[model samples]
Target chain A: MKAVGLVAEYNPLHNGHLYHLKMAKQITKADVTVAVMSGNFTQRAEPTILDKWQRTKEALSVGVDLVVELPMQYAVQPAHLFASGALSLLDSLQIDDFVFGAEHPDWDFNSLVQAENKFESTDFSKYNATYATAFNNQLIEHTGISLTEPNDILAFGYTKAKLKSKLSVNLHPVKRVGSAYHDEKIDDTSSISSASAIRKAVKNGSAGFESLVPEQTAVDLKELKDVNDWNDLYPLLRYQLIQAPLNYLAQTYQMSEGLEHRLKQAAQRASDFDAFMRLAKSKRYTYSRIQRVCLYALLQISDEQMQIKNKQLYLRILGFNHLGQEYLHQIKKTVKIPIITKVDQKSRDGQLQLDYRAGKLYEQLSGVEQDMRRRPIIV
Target chain B: MKAVGLVAEYNPLHNGHLYHLKMAKQITKADVTVAVMSGNFTQRAEPTILDKWQRTKEALSVGVDLVVELPMQYAVQPAHLFASGALSLLDSLQIDDFVFGAEHPDWDFNSLVQAENKFESTDFSKYNATYATAFNNQLIEHTGISLTEPNDILAFGYTKAKLKSKLSVNLHPVKRVGSAYHDEKIDDTSSISSASAIRKAVKNGSAGFESLVPEQTAVDLKELKDVNDWNDLYPLLRYQLIQAPLNYLAQTYQMSEGLEHRLKQAAQRASDFDAFMRLAKSKRYTYSRIQRVCLYALLQISDEQMQIKNKQLYLRILGFNHLGQEYLHQIKKTVKIPIITKVDQKSRDGQLQLDYRAGKLYEQLSGVEQDMRRRPIIV
Candidate 1:
């Protein structure tokens, strides 16, 4: 049983994503495709606009054979950790090939794979210095090309993890199409747009985004009225900023020394949350990073908690089709953790309950009380 | 002469800047205003968009009575160095006060000054983490607020320098108006717009920037076509990236240890300068910091050079009115360094030649041809 793997959010599988799914089947000629996707949160350190289950169903309706949850621990992490978690899941299932998108589609992957395999472990003592020395060295030796954008960095992360895992899985990269990543401008050249561009258009109420996504995804977006958005989190963030001890703030993820004092000062002067963030921004810390740190502080994610929860854990099931059922049967004995298909009351551990509560909050924020019905396992 | 001192670039005095000049004089009730402007480069580590002479002439046309050139050593230094240089110039002229903009219009200058004065003796060793730690403690003790934004940090620098110099000059802060600093948005509420926004608009060919700047500055900008921009320096930066020793690169300004190796690897993989920078960026080091470091490396500014140039230096004159002349004469005997209004051709040394050469580059880049018959300095 030849099996291929994908790592994505699906968030609402668009036509462009479907095209990749079809092309993966045609090119790899694989019997099954398993998608290891984010559960509730996204890579941007924000809650997904849609629930994971809805996104899973969308993927299933498209061409995806099976959908497995990429546990929350890895989902919200930086690119490398996210990739490692997804790749580990696929490796455990004994998948043969992994596919992704790249700006330069014609670039050879075999050379990259070979380079990844042959990378040396040098002293990264200066790792905390001015730049990321070890990561760059590996990238240069592997691709013979530099990582330029966020997407490129992510691709490099995937490659690095593949190398570190010592897995023999083949790497496939498809050509990125249409709008450039973070390019808010709509293009008529191709019927594809980056998720960033789509999100921007949605937020700004800009025109020409509908044609870029699948019809069902658009419908889902339209029907989805309320969810936990940035604004909803602002008040909570503000309260946290006011109440959090300066020392405790320094312990949260991404909260460096001295930044806490600055944050504390800005909180007093700012009339609201946005004003506070604006005042807190500095040359070294980007606005996105500050926002993430603020969120983490609000959530009270301590240094010790972060240390323990940073690793990949159980593989939760979201959705699956007929082909997915067969693939699951083949790999059922080899899997490490429980592949949860239903919200089992018996399996609701402390952490799992917290995850479920987060999901419930997400549903309430998104204005979808009716969709809270427990989903049945297709398999 | 009761004069107010300004440390500025003028760089084509826009309307909002003109408003600042007018307001400073009106509020401070000063007879004259002197501006210590940059010779060629700016504090942000970029060359001025227009030549210094052109910028000086524009400043003179507005409310400025005198314009002095901030020596290159001071002009291109970091916030503390830049502030110290500007303060030294004002001190030499015996200016009574120094006025500037602050995000929190309500910032208390006396308290700030007191905090800065007390900081040196304070037990800052208890928070011996980074520069930010000691600075924040001072701010908290002074105003019970945390220091957050770049401008606030700069204000702190200015206050610290003023207190350390023991200059009897008062600190005054005006509330910034219109769009937020570095905000790309165009708001017509107030004429004030950040220099970053104006530069961005100019680069993108957007209109409505004229209203944001003074009329004279806009005319100067129109006259100065084909100015040397960052694009022209890309080749030089690329060469530096390629040839710079990994160890030396590590010592370049913000180039942390491990970052040098990352940069070295990136240089090898990147086909161009921009690609190299992108590859080198990470969560730890921002793109701006990287760009500044690259520029520092290109200029061969070592840690040793930085240490020597970190202190304040003498001032050079650009242009001045009658009142400014009176103000200069009053403190002529007490001034620390030679008030160089005219170039000393016979005494031109290596440093002077270097300064002159940088100025000449600015002239050439501004697309203005110099008349061979004209003297190097304009009276």
Candidate 2:
């Protein structure tokens, strides 16, 4: 059976996302497609607009052949780690091919992947000292191979991970059509935009977003009563800041030398989370980074805990389509670790408890508790 | 006499500029205001929207005490050089005080100036290399005085120039009111914005720009039938790129190393100036820098010529208010060069000819020929 693998969040599958899946199927001519999706949180360290089950069900109903859960550890990482986690899962599943979008898709995929793989060997210690430098160095290294472009960098990561795992999967890249990845403007002509743009459009109540997403995804979003954002979680963040010991607070993600002291001092002075965030942000730490760190602190994710949970372990199932079920059955015999679908009392171990707690927080924060209790939608 | 020095381009006196003049008068309580205005080109290396005569007249009509033109050498420079030229001119006039707008008006001016002066002493070979070092050094030097901030940097430049020149003028910074310098949104609360923001608003044809500029300036701008930007100059830039010898092209302002070779090759292959610029621009050379170099190439300005003209000489008059005449007369004996009030064919020298050519180009490109020919509007 010709099988293709997708790495995504599907955080609430939109129209554009559905179109991508449909296009992937048509272009690849694959019999089955498996998606590795994030659980509660996103890369930006924010709760998803919809519950994971709803998002998973939505993906299955649309087109995905199989739906596998991306662990929380991988879901909230930067591009490289995220790709590593997703590719590892797909490798274990014995997927035949991989597809992704790129601004310049006409470029050669194998050459780009090769270039990216070559770049990993070069020591970029000088440039890696700073965030921008490290990012640009990675770009430069990949550029040696045809994949030196921005979008290709992510694709290159996936290819490199696959190569490392000795997974035999052909790479397919679709030309990214429509507005820029982070462009806030809506171009009615092509109507495709990055998820960041979609989220921003929704938050700002911008017109034309309805046309951007898939029709069903738009309907689902519209049906949802509450739309939560970072600002809404300010009170929770404040509680976390006030309650957490200094040592625990200092160990959160992105928290660096002496920053915890400043954060602690600022938290004491400020009445709200916004004020504390504003006070804590310096030239070195961007507002977004601070926000992520704050979320990590709220989740009580200490440095030791993060170190232990840094790597992907098991693929947790969210939802799947008919083709997805067949692929799952086929992979179950060969795959590593448990492919968790249902969570019972026995499944609530240390890591499972953490996942459950995260789910509870997500449901409470997003006001999607009723949706979570509803039966998972099957294609 | 209590005299205040103004550093400006007076690119046609707008309403918001008039507000600055009125505020300066009230705050400084100066008997006379001396304006050191740009001759033809502006700091962005672009021709002023209007000719110097029309701009001077508008300044005169408003409240300027004296109008002295800043030499073209210093006129089209970066922020530091631009500030130096203006400060030197004000120093030459032996003005007692200088006033400028700052985001945080309450910031300590003297300490900031002291820090800037110290920062300039460290000889750094590479650009932006010493930026952080100089900044931290300045902070250390000024410990217990005041914290270093961004807005203070510009104010500090003025102070340093004055100190270096041994000028008697005291620096006075006014708190900036209204919209932020880089604010993209139109602010209805205060109808004032940075010149950059105003230009963007006008270019975008966004509403509420009418409130940004003076009524007379707005009327003057409206009378100009066409507004041409870089796109319109593309063909001209492209032609210059193709015609100029590679060696000669490299001598243009901001052109460095083998960029001229790159430009020459790009120009041959690209359809237009924009395409050529895009090809030439890399991580090292910014788009704005490339545009300036292209302008310099179009003007046939050589490195030798630029070197010779590095030092500011003659001040070209534009327009002035009632007090401006009295101030001009007061400093007439102390002035180094003969100020040109009207363009005389017999008396106009090489620099004046070049200035006039730049003005003519501005008129042609901006489609403000009729406006250019009009008698100065003495306010």
Q: What is the C-alpha lDDT profile of model 1 across B1-379, one tens digit per residue? A: 7988887776545665776787789789998898888877777667787767777777877768888877766676667777777777778777888888677757765476666656655343455444555667767876688876666656766887877877798878776556666677766676777776777667676787788877776776555445556665554444345433356466675566466777756654454556777888765555555666665665445575556654435556677767667777787888877666555543233334335534433443353422212232223
For candidate 2, lDDT tens digit of each residue in A1-379?
A: 7798887776557655766687788888899988888877876678887767767767777778777777766666666677888788777777887777666766664565565445444343433344534545665555643333446656767766767777777778777666666566666667676676777777776766777676666777777766777766654554345333466567776677667777765654455567777788776655656766766666556666667876537767766676777777887897877676666545543445446546645654554442223443567
lDDT for predicted candidate 1 compared with the true structure: 0.66
Q: List, residue by residue over A297-355, the lDDT tens digit for candidate 1.
A: 65455666666755536666677888888888888998886676656544432335435
The segments of candidate 2 whose C-alpha lies over 4 angstroms from its true place after superposition are A106-129, A137-150, A270-276, A286-288, A370-376, B1-379
Question: Chain A TM-scores, one per candidate?
Answer: 0.84, 0.85
Model 1 chain A weakest 10-residue run by lDDT: A363-372
DockQ for model 2 equals 0.01
Q: Where is the poorest 10-residue window by lDDT in model 1 chain B?
A: B369-378
On a 0 to 100 scale, what is the lDDT of residue B39 in model 1? 72
For every model in order, the fraction of real contacts preserved is 0.00, 0.00
Model 1 misplacement above 4 A: A105-144, A226-228, A271-274, A344-354, A367-373, A376-379, B1-379
